[model samples]
Structure formats: structure tokens, C-alpha cells
Target: MYHVVLGVDEDEQRAESAAREIANLPGGSDEKRVTLIHVFQDNPSGASATQVASVRDAEEVLKAAGVDVSISEASGDPADAILELAEEDDADLVVVGGRKRSPAGKALFGSVTQTVILNAGRPVMVTGVPTEA
Candidate 1:
């Protein structure tokens, strides 16, 4: 089984791309379990529509492919939450969405993707949106 990190900032394309990549990954079976996770910084009010929509899109795609899928939400640091869940679940891999950010941008803003990639013990697959120059 694998865990896909769904950030609050993610869009439909990001969600769909992650699902497509998972679906195409070799060795998938009906026995495989895929969890779509969205981490909110606070989320006192509950999940945002965007987050719900993204999860639903990925869930539908995976379900239609006959893969066992589930959705989860957490509140905390995005990178930490993702890694903790992955470790807790003993996931085979970690998949996440990324954006094209310059080095300075990443340094200034701090990237969840980079943090997860650097800290995660298991494999991490980063699917990114194409950026225009």
C-alpha cells in the first residue's frame, strides 16, 4: 500500500495526476490499498470544498480502477503529518504533488515536497505541474 499526500493548496490537476501515476504504477492489485491524505494547518471548521473535491476525484479514479482506496484528513505541519502517517501505516511508497519553484522561492517559502523527500525513509514520488517559462 502507498500514501499520497494531498496538501490544502493542491488543485484538481495535481490530484488527478497523482491518481493516474498510481494507477499506472507496476504491481498494482485488488489487494493493494491506497490512501489519499489531506493535511490542514488548522481546519477547525472542517475540510474545504477544494480539498474534498480533490480527494473525491482521486478516490473515484482509483476506485474505478478497482483499487482499494480511502481518504483521510489531519491537522498539523503538512510535511510532518504526511511522513508520520506514512511511517504509521508502513506504506510502501509516498506520492505527492509539486510545483515549479525556484531555489530562492523554495528557501523563502519552504516546500512541503522537499521536506518530505528529504525526511521520508521510504520511496517518494513527486508528481509536478508543468511550469511555463
Candidate 2:
């Protein structure tokens, strides 16, 4: 079976995009499984991964497409958590969402997507918010 680790943040658009990508993979969903993960850097209220809006939206899209879905949660650094989960799951691919940022902005704020792409030993798919026509 093909496995994928989909790392989602608070951005619902990006999460849906990544989910759609997985749903549209060449092979049918019968052999595909997705682990939807969300990492919280600081959670004062202690939210679960299943409680994440982005994760819920992605899950609906994936399930409607007949893909198997699972949820995982972690605390601390987002990139590190995502990578760890991907490794543990032996994921065939890691998917993440990215926002368009200026070089200076990215330098100042840092990018979890960039870090994951650079560090992931396996394939990483980065999805961005869709542009309006």
C-alpha cells in the first residue's frame, strides 16, 4: 500500500489542495492511505489534531475520494514533528502547505515547508493556496 504523511497547519485552503492532490494520484485510492498530522507550536487550550479545522476539511475531501485517512497530533516544532511522523509511518511521500512569501519575509519568519523539503530523506510535495482566476 502507498502511504502519505500530510502535514497541515491552520490554513484550510492549502490543506484542501494537498488532499486533492493525493486524491488525484494516478493509482486508485484502494492502495493509498494518508496520515493527516498537525503540530502545535503553542497550544494554550490543548487542541487535538482532529480538532484542527484544516485537518477536518482535508479528511472530508480525502474520504469522499475513497482514500483511507488517519489523524495524528504532536507538540513542539512543526517541521520536526512532521518529519518524525513521516519517518515513523514509513511514508512514501510527505505533503505540506506553503504560503507565498517574499525572500525577506521567509528569512525573517522562517518556513516549515522549506525546512521539510530540505531535510526530508524521502519525497516531499508542497502545495500552495490556489490563485483566483
Candidate 3:
């Protein structure tokens, strides 16, 4: 079993695509198991039900694919939450979704994927989110 923490965002299609890709991976087969996690920071304004639904919907896709899925939520900084979970779970791999950014921008304010890859003891997979044309 592998710990596959798929980060979800407002674009349901992207998250669904990510979940589908994870599902198709050899390690995500019926013989294997994976966990699905979503991080939610407390935005003072709050998140609409639609955003939460996207995560729940993605979880369903992974579960239907035969992966032993666990859905969870986390608060605080995105990178910190992921790293904490990785260490606490002794995860084999950490997966994340990212939007492409300039190196300078990324370096100034580290991306969640970049930070996790640099600090995580385990392997990390980062999927870049496609900006709608």
C-alpha cells in the first residue's frame, strides 16, 4: 500500500483528472491501496460547499478504483500540513498539485511541492495544474 496524498482545488476537473491518474497507476490497483487527502485552511470568508464537494467527489473516484482511500482535511500553511502528515504517517510518497510559477516567485515564497520535495524523506510527486486556455 502507498500513501497517495492528492491535493485538490476549486477546479474539479483537475482534481478528478489527478485522482484518475492515481487510480490508473500500478500501485493503485485492487491489489494495492492508497490514501486520498485534502487540505483546507480556514479562510475567514470560508469555503463554499462546491469546493468541499469537489474533494469528496474525487475521493469517490479513487475509492471506486479499488484503492483503500482515506479522506482527511488539514489547516495551517499548505506545505507545513503536507510535511507534517508525511512524517506522522511515515508515508511512502507525497503527491501534490501545483500551478506553474516563475523560479524567482517560487523561490521567494516556496511552493508546497517544492518545499515537500526538498524536506520530505519520502519520494514526492508534483502534478502541475493546467491553466485553462
Candidate 4:
């Protein structure tokens, strides 16, 4: 029963896809143990993830895929929050949706997944999208 982190960013489609993919992991569905985590870069001003979908959506997706689900929502620096939760939960794997940013985007804001990959102690699985979001 390895803990899986689905890095949700208000973008529902991306979040959903990432969760399903992780749920499809080799032993994920068989053991029925996985979790969804959404990190919001809200702070320094008081901002939180605007709810467009319920936690049930996350649960249902994995449940339908034959995996048990634990869900969480957080606000703060995206990278720090994910790594902290993974360590605290003793997660075996940290799964995140990787965004394809243009050079401009990269120049403006760095990659959270990259930072997490560099710092997280656990094995990390990053799902990279071909198209820009």
C-alpha cells in the first residue's frame, strides 16, 4: 500500500488524468491503496483552490479503477507541501502531473515537479503532458 500523490492545480482535467494514470500503476489497483493530494500556491495573500470538483471525484476515479482512495487539499508552496506530506505519510511514490511550459513560462515561473524530484526522498513518477495547458 504505497501512498500516491495526485498534484491537483485547479485544472480539473489535468488533475483527473494524473490520478487515473497513477491508479493504473502496476500494483496500484490490485492493492487498492492510493491517495490524491492537491497543492495550492495560496498564501502570502490568502488564496485557496476554488472547488470545481469534490473530493469524491478523486475517490470515485480511483475507486472505479479498483483502488482505495485517501484525499487531501493544501495551501502553500506547492513543492514544499507535497514533499512534506510524502515524508509524513511515508509515501513510497510521489506521482505528479508535469506541465509543459513554454520557454516564456519556464522563464517566468520555475517547475514545481522539478524541484520536488530534486528534493523528495521517495521515488517520484511525473506524468508529462505533450501539449501546453
Candidate 5:
């Protein structure tokens, strides 16, 4: 079975886009297992990954598409947590959502997506928010 680590942030659109991409993979749902993960940088309230709206939405999309899904939560640096989870799961692929950022902006704020792409030992797929016509 193909295993994918899907790292979802707070953005619903980006999460859904990534879920849709996984759902449409050529091998079909039965051959794939998706681990939906959300890393909270700060959570004084102690929230679970499934409580995150984007995570829930992505789970719904994946389930509707007949994909097997599991939710995971971690508290720490997002990129670090995601990469750790991928390694632990022995994921076939790591998928993340990225926002459009200018070079200067990305340089100033750093990018988890960029870090994952550069550091991941496994293949990484970056999905972006769709643009409206």
C-alpha cells in the first residue's frame, strides 16, 4: 500500500487541494493510506488535530473520495514534526500546502514548504490555493 503524509495547516483551501490531489492518484483509494497531520506551534488550549477545521475538511474530502484516512497531532515546529512523522510512517510521499510568497517575503519569513522540499528524504508535493478566473 502507498502511504502519504499530508501536512495540513489552517488554510482550508490549501488542505482541500492537497486532499483532492491525493484522492485522484492513479492507484485508487484502496491502495493508498493518508495520514492527515497538523502541527500546532502554540496551543495553550490543547487542541487536537481533528479539531482543526482545515483538518476536518480535508478528512471529509478524502473520505468522500473513498480514501483511507487517519488524523495525527503534534506540537512543535511544523516542518520538524511533519518530517518526523513522514520518516516514522515511512511515507511514500509527503504533501504540503504552500502560499504564494515573493522572494523577499519568503526570505524574511522563512517557508515550511521550502524547508520540507529541501530536507525531506522522500518525495514532497506542494499544493497551492486555486486562483479564481
Candidate 6:
């Protein structure tokens, strides 16, 4: 089973890339369970259309690959919410999607991906967004 953390604001293509990586994992034909989690920075009245669309897109991608999937929504610090949920769910792996940033940009902005990688107690898989030329 895997706990996949997705940024609600991320581009759909980037999010699907993460799903594709998980779907391509060895032994994935056994109907592995995937929990797709999205942490909303702002607590909206409810899920917005864009959030729903993003979740549905990722769910479709994983399902097409034969994964049993569930979607979750939370509001808080992105990295912290993901870590907490992964630990609570006893996830075997953590998967996250992110865009590559320059070293200086990462240092200055303090990336959530970096924090999750540093703090997650389980194995983490990172899928990078394609860089625009």
C-alpha cells in the first residue's frame, strides 16, 4: 500500500506523473491500495471544482493501472499533514510529486518536498515534473 501526497495546486500533468510512477512499480498487478491525499492550504467551504478535478484525474490514472484507490482531503501544513496521515495509515511507502527547483530557490523557499523526504519514517518516492525549456 502507498500513501500518495499531492499538492492541490500542482498541474494535472505533474500529478499524473506521480501516479504513473506508482502504477509502474513492480508487483503492482496485485491490486495494491493507494491512498491519495491532498492538503489544502486554505480551509475552503468544501472541495473546489479544480481540487475535485485533480483528484479525479489522479484516481483515474491509478485505477486504469489496476490500483485500488481512495482519496482524502485535509487542511494544514502540507508536509506535516502528509507525514501525519502516512504514519496514521501505516503506509508502506510515501509518494510525492514536485517540480525541480534551483538550489537557491529551495533554500530560500524551504520546500515541502524536502521536509517530507527528511522526516518521513518510511520509504519515499519522488516524481519530478518535466521542466519547461
Stretches of candidate 3 above 4 Å error? 43-51, 102-110, 130-133
Query: 3-78, model 1: which lDDT tens digit per residue?
Result: 4444334577778878877887876656567878887776767765335777788888788888888776777787
Largest lDDT belongs to which candidate?
Answer: 5
**Each candidate's clash count:** 0, 0, 0, 0, 0, 0
Q: Per-residue lDDT of 15-124 in model 5, one digit per residue for the tens?
A: 99999999998897899999999999999998898899999999999999999999999988999999999999899999998787887686632478878998899999
Best to worst by TM-score, what's the order?
A: 5, 2, 6, 1, 4, 3
Put down candidate 2 lDDT per residue, 94-130, tens digits, no spaces: 9988787787676632378888998999999887788
Worst 10 residues of 4 by lDDT: 47-56
lDDT of 3 by residue, 1-133 (tens): 5666665665576677777777877743765455555666665656643358767777778778877776666767777877887777777777776565687676543366678778888888766555679
**TM-score of each model, paired residue for residue:** 0.81, 0.93, 0.75, 0.77, 0.94, 0.82
Q: Which tens-of-lDDT digit does each residue in 1-133 have in candidate 6?
A: 4444444334677678888888888775454778887888765577643456667788788889988887777777989988888888888888877775687676532477778889998888878766679
Q: Which pairs clash inside model 1?
A: none
lDDT of 1: 0.74
lDDT of each: 0.74, 0.90, 0.68, 0.70, 0.91, 0.74
The regions of model 2 sitting more than 4 angstroms off are: 103-110
lDDT of 4 at 57: 62
Cα lDDT, model 5, residue 105: 80
At residue 48, what lDDT does model 4 achieve? Answer: 35
Instruction: Give me the runs in candidate 6 sitting further than 4 Å from their true place.
Output: 1-9, 48-51, 106-110, 131-133
